[model samples]
Target: MELQQMRYVLAVAETANFTRAAERCHVVQSALSHQIKRLEHELGAELFARTSRRVRLTPAGEAFLPAARQCLEAADRAAAEAAATVGEVRGRLSVGVIPTVAAVDVPAALRDLRRRHPQVRVALRTGASDDLTAEVANGRLDVAFLGLPSSSRPTGVQSHELARDHLVAVLARDHPLADGGQLDLADLSAEPFVDFPYGSAGRAQTDHAFAHAKLTRDVAFEVTDAALMAQVIRHGLAIGFLPSAYLQRAPELRGLAAITVTNAPSRVEYVVWGSPGPSPATVAFLATIGLQPTPE
Candidate 1:
């Protein structure tokens, strides 16, 4: 029996509706039915019992389902290994990203990844750190750059903490405490603060810092983008904490007064992935960002 036949069988078994299975398998219902019928003939046994309302797996189908899944998985692994060894990686790599979380130079990394693997294509999607982590866990993403807890990652996924930057408080130049040169989490306790949304790395770090000090601030706004949060700080809307790199990299941000928060938590970014065999393009992308195929 062919792999296509086995896939059709599995799809039908899962959906229990030939039409739905056919749609999922990207084939006409008639064609899928033909393949399943042909496979059953080859095996000298009927695999599915079809009725007007539903399809049920026969005893033979139930017995064959696990083996069929294993066969497809093995084929995928063999194909991946062959592609890895042949030469430059030439396939699509789906990458999920979080804003300001991983501290990666994504443009530079992509440029170098393209130079190294010209045939590879990279697809980028931006989301919250938790959302990206979920995508990585479900294998919808080949890899992601996110701010994740060191030990709370999904079971099948691995994450490596590449680097960490200290969090600093950003504020208007005219703010009362801006001239202090340095501050602490408690210093901002009375100020209405702007913060990263829950589940984002920056937000997590800030929360930990406050919790460690047994203090809480009045959060006036929750934003995911550091640039926007900085803008709010610049307008004197509220104080906010940003990775020191953000303060250093953006020229416009330099106009604002930024102070180191001695008691604030440091935010670490991670490069994370699911399973083991990533495409050549993904491996190249990782290397461009000062990483290796192995996960921590």
Candidate 2:
């Protein structure tokens, strides 16, 4: 019934070990166990099944975990709102990003957010769009900036389009067709290819482009890091197909040329968050990106 007791129960349920749960709660094992026992006595049901090897959540525990997390999140937000009313925003803000992003000036946005909300601590997690999308839905991330398919969208979350950037062919300055100004996938069919890893959001666009042309590229390298891929292209190790904006922004690919690919698909970058309602930090960050504020 007590907020502290609710925290203890959730911790125990999450860790599945009373000792580790107590450690996480910064309390002695006996104190945490006593609180959980008191909670179970009040509910008139066992919340956990303990054995010599492991602890498993009982049916009651499984059902109670979500509500406990919601209560904690609500309490934290109430405290944050109270602080904000006094002209202070004091809370942790966690944002997720994909490996490569061209839709938003993320660094500039973060700089502005930090300037405006000095009390807010921020962290960034990077991954592919699919992985980061799941993180947002599961409440691990407050917002995610990443590339999503122009034709397909994510479920269970709200997404706002930030920008659509074309995927273009990149090659060394002296390479053949480097000065072509405009090219297509078929032009690179016989060339050594470098690209984002297959099945990724960026690679999907490139793959779709090739499939549309009925031509298969001789991809010699698949890289996830844009800087490294640019370096690979600059050395003439392989030709690359990446976001045009990304190549433009990367100083590492200074000697490379980006060819506009006619009929190519653009990687649409979007900002996404959970549907429970946008977090205050997420809304504030979006403002710098010129989005309408997410209402509470």
Candidate 3:
């Protein structure tokens, strides 16, 4: 009859052990048994055949199981919808981002999100683009800011473009190509290169750039953080590609050089939602942050 009763029934059906079910449901075994007895009394039939060794569902219980599940699912959906309607977008929002985006302008976006949706708490995690994409697809994350080279058809999830960022090669100020207005892959091929971890969005871009130009790199180091890579380049260790947005934040790396790559692809950042679409707060947060909704 009640949602809690339905939930209890589902849990009992899963475990088939009163003590285990009660523990999983965070209730006392006696209370669980009493509630099941009450439910059986209301239905005028025993839902479970209890024995010393174990409990098993009865015919009636088998027939009622699907209906009980449906009832609980419907109630949960209705509650979620009602919460959205009331604009009560107040809950934990687990967000994922690639290291480049996390260090880029993504923080500015979060500041705006918090300013608009003060009640929505956020947890930020950063990883490689592939890892973030997989997490979003598998429902480990509620939403994420994923670099676009990693973007593809949203299989089992919904996604929208956040922004387009220009990709540039970061280099040491005194390096030969630094002062040259523009440099191609051929010019930098022999230059010691710092690259993103293989399989990352930035590395994908780097690979593509080299592939397009028929060039190869002598990578000296690989790192996830573009800012740190910039530092590495400053010391003339290796040079790598990063977004222009990264330049705006690193005032300390003043002597570092950034050269816009010609004929190379730019990176697009996306805001992705893990299954069941966005919560009201998330929707509003995206809108507030100016991410255009992707057509369904």
lDDT of each: 0.79, 0.81, 0.74
Rank by TM-score, highest first. 2, 1, 3
**How do the candidates rank by lDDT, highest first?**
2, 1, 3
Cα RMSD to native, each candidate?
Answer: 6.5, 4.4, 7.8
The prediction achieving the highest TM-score against the true structure is 2
* Lowest summed lDDT window (length 10), candidate 3: 148-157
Cα lDDT over the full model 3: 0.74
CA error at residue 115 for candidate 2, angstroms = 1.9
What TM-score does each of the candidates earn? Answer: 0.69, 0.73, 0.67
lDDT of 2 by residue, 1-296 (tens): 98899899888877889999999999999998898899999999988999989999999989888898889877877877778777776676788887678667787899999999987788887888887888888887888988866766766688888777777788889898898777766777889988777787767877777787898877799887888888888888998877777766777778788788787767788898777766666667777788764443
Worst 10-residue lDDT window, candidate 2 = 287-296
Q: Which tens-of-lDDT digit does each residue in 1-296 have in candidate 3?
A: 67788788889899999899999999999998888889889999999999999989999999999988867755654665577776765555678877666233667777887876677777889877667778877756767777756334345667766667667888888888888988667777888888887766668777776877888888889887766787788898888777777566667557788887775556777777766665555576667666545546
> In candidate 2, how many Å is residue 291 off?
2.2
Q: What TM-score number comes out for model 1?
A: 0.69
Between candidates 2 and 3, the one scoring higher on TM-score is 2
CA shift at 231, candidate 1, in angstroms? Answer: 1.7
